[model samples]
Target: MSYRQKQLVMQYAEINNVLDFRLKPELKEALNNIHKQLRKLDDDRERIYLEYSQKLA
Candidate 1:
């Protein structure tokens, strides 16, 4: 696999481990919310990058 793909896989594993750790319900909910927001931001970044790359081509 490509270096970028490997890095993303590792990052996802780390996030999963963090979510698995024992924590209160409120804190867990907050963390899950943050994760959701981060995923959305990543999606946005990928979309912008794709647009820029297409424009360059």
Candidate 2:
């Protein structure tokens, strides 16, 4: 990579190490809850589709 690109990447890594932006417990829990809700919605969608398809057949 070019020198400027290398510098920018190194700067980003240093800032990330200092900040640790993705390591908050509340943020992680919120993400987990959203994931669970999405999974439930997907399951419900599949179940309803199957039920309707069976009825129409």
Candidate 3:
């Protein structure tokens, strides 16, 4: 869970503190951004590893 989720849960533990509808779009955007960043990182890591491996081969 994100920091926002933790804060919400701490403030409203009952009923699992359902998310407010208004934040849904923002949450989706944040998730999309994270996925894009992670994908880029993975691609870069793989490319760098291959580059080094080829050099040592």
Candidate 4:
């Protein structure tokens, strides 16, 4: 898996970890922020790849 895939896997693990409600509110907010950033990263990666492939074509 690539770096972003690894990050997504780790994020999945983090989500599982939080499912038990063991984290504090601030920590939960931070995790949510991380989730948002990761999603944006994924979106940006897709856009970049599309642009790159078009350039190659």
Of 1 and 4, the candidate ahead on lDDT is 4
RMSD of each: 5.3, 13.4, 8.3, 2.8
- Which ten contiguous residues of candidate 2 have the minimum total lDDT? 1-10
Could you tell me the C-alpha RMSD of candidate 2 in Å?
A: 13.4
What is the overall TM-score of model 1 with all chains considered together? 0.57
Q: How many backbone clashes does candidate 4 have?
A: 0
Which sections of candidate 1 miss by over 4 Å? 1-23
Q: Who wins the TM-score comparison? A: 4
Query: In candidate 3, what residue range of length 10 has the lowest lDDT sum?
Result: 7-16
lDDT of each candidate versus the true structure: 0.65, 0.60, 0.59, 0.75
Off by over 4 Å in 3: 1-22
lDDT of 1: 0.65
lDDT of 3 by residue, 1-57 (tens): 245445444543432344673655565555555556556666777899899999999
Alpha-carbon shift of residue 10 in model 3 (angstroms): 17
- Candidate 4 whole-model C-alpha lDDT, 0 to 1: 0.75
How close is every model to the real structure, measured as TM-score?
A: 0.57, 0.59, 0.59, 0.61
TM-score of structure candidate 2? 0.59
Candidate 4 per-residue lDDT over residues 1-39, each given as its tens digit? 268767876875776577556555666676777778778
lDDT of 2 by residue, 1-57 (tens): 245445545554554455544665454555465556556666777899899999999
Error of 2 at 14 (Å): 24
Candidate numbers, best lDDT first, in rank order: 4, 1, 2, 3
